[model samples]
Target: MSDKAPKPLNLLDYHRPKRLRLKDARIPPLNAESKRCLRNLTAYRPSRPKFPYPQTRSAAVLVALFVGRMGDLYVLLNRRSATLRTYAGDTSLPGGKWDPEDRTIEDTARREAFEEIGLPRDKLKVPLLCILEPFLAARNLIVTPVIVLILDNTLRFPFSLTHSPLFSPPLPRFPTEPELIEVPYHTTNEWTYPGPNDTTLTTRAHRFLTGREAGGIKPVFGLTAAILIHAASIAHARQPDFEVELAPPEGQSREERIAWAIYSSPVFHEAYEAEEIKVDWAKVAKTAGGKGGGRSTRR
Candidate 1:
């Protein structure tokens, strides 16, 4: 009314560019719940008589839990080189027996991971997921499996002489098959020589005592399987809607087709494949809230 032609309605009020701009913006702290859930999970302790079996020696294993942009989760596994002394060409977690320099079982897991897979501890945003009870399978040693969540997407690994060339490749996505597999413990009953013994020595050679089968449980049985089952339970409890369908072509007989599906599935491949299901990122962004868009505009 002050002779300014009604002071023209405010641009923000009429056009609302701020609101539209915010409509397309992504959610802040994209990994908030994941981080929190991992934290709470680490704090939990399983009941006493923690280990069901008796262990004669101490050993450790690590399960690398990685979450991708599309919210898909994966675990890292290494295939031992066929030329190795033991467990050659077998799939297993990246870990080994505790060293004298190690402080805790966690330290052993970290150190072993660094040595076997070349994943630097600094590059990972790993939170302790869980500590599984020790498992024994005809072996004289007790094995502990530790699970950790890897939050960073750009993580990398280098190949070592003892590992297979396949695992040397940069793994930005999950593996198509089960990450870890247990093989039977190779042993021999032949006696070893003991020089100048009054009584003949009958020492049985049990060289590969630790490399034992996981019984009848999808080839990844034993302590490693226990760790996975527990971690899956925890994740399901937090997000009931989260589902993990196997990357299709599960039983296909064709090698090429199976390999193709493995490398193309959203759960496996780093690059998008035609067969991969497309997620509506816009809807997700809006649900998370844009900068200035009306809260109820979606309706």
Candidate 2:
């Protein structure tokens, strides 16, 4: 445990004055394509974790989408400052770890966006489209992707000079006539591990080359890339041009895999306990080990 004391929650930090409210948040009229995308996003239902998770280990990323001049959909992204200690110079969505003062996961996302990119915290200006299921990240952190639409693009911000903003169309777009939306380029690597009852579970990690002429932006890979793939697939209502990895026919589903990880991995189990949630010993026993279970570690 850390020697530092936990920060106290401040409800008023998230409140905005009534004088700042406006009848029109400067949101432009949505085109037909934008409307369809919005409808699809609004209807999406993301999966949840099978076991309880500690809020202290949670983080969020804002997948902010907007309409481009040609009515095509685009997402906002930034290259991290190279001076950062971890994942420096990487391309990522605007977000950070959960804060004690945040009232909810959505609040954590909104607060991080406001602090990172100067995005207004007002919901009317940038409305949320969806909150995706949690993804296990490095250091046993659970990252939730918050999807929101940037209605008022005219809002200016004093973004950090170290962070460079990059705007690109959502994935898997072809070079349509009279437009230069580049083709999506990506590659996947498969990973497998032994499971309960002599079974084997496999998953794929994806890497997307952000090659749209951004001078200093790094490629979107790992968690960031995977989240974008999911968001784009939902928004466009079509699968990616390339093959996407799925659980084996007889293996565990995505949620089940996460649950298995929490039960099997010592690091994750500690997180589960830190939340003061009781473990289902029966479920854990069912997935603990088997005759064919290998000793290889999972990344």
Number of the top TM-score candidate: 2
Query: Could you list the CA RMSD of all candidates, in the order they appear?
Result: 26.1, 6.5
Per-residue alpha-carbon lDDT of candidate 1 for residues 1-299, written as tens digits (9 for 90 to 100): 23221121111121111221112333223365445444555555543331111111345777776655644455676666778786666556788875555546666677788788875564235555566554332233445666665655566666744744322211111122233345323223333322111223222222122222332112343334334544555644442222222122221211222222222233322222222323333332232222222211111
Clashing pairs in 2: none
lDDT of 2 at 99: 79
Give the worst 10-residue stretch by lDDT in candidate 2: 11-20
Looking at candidate 1, the ten consecutive residues that score lowest on lDDT are: 8-17
Q: Which stretches of candidate 2 lie over 4 Å from their true place?
A: 1-29, 161-184, 192-201, 249-252, 284-299
Q: Which whole-number lDDT from 0 to 100 does residue 279 have in model 1?
A: 31
Per residue, candidate 2 scores C-alpha lDDT tens digits across 34-140 of: 66777788777665343455566678898887777766677878778889899988888888888767777778988888887888887877887787776667666
Backbone clash pairs for candidate 1 read 185-211, 185-212
Candidates in order, TM-scores: namely 0.46, 0.76
lDDT of 2 at 107: 87
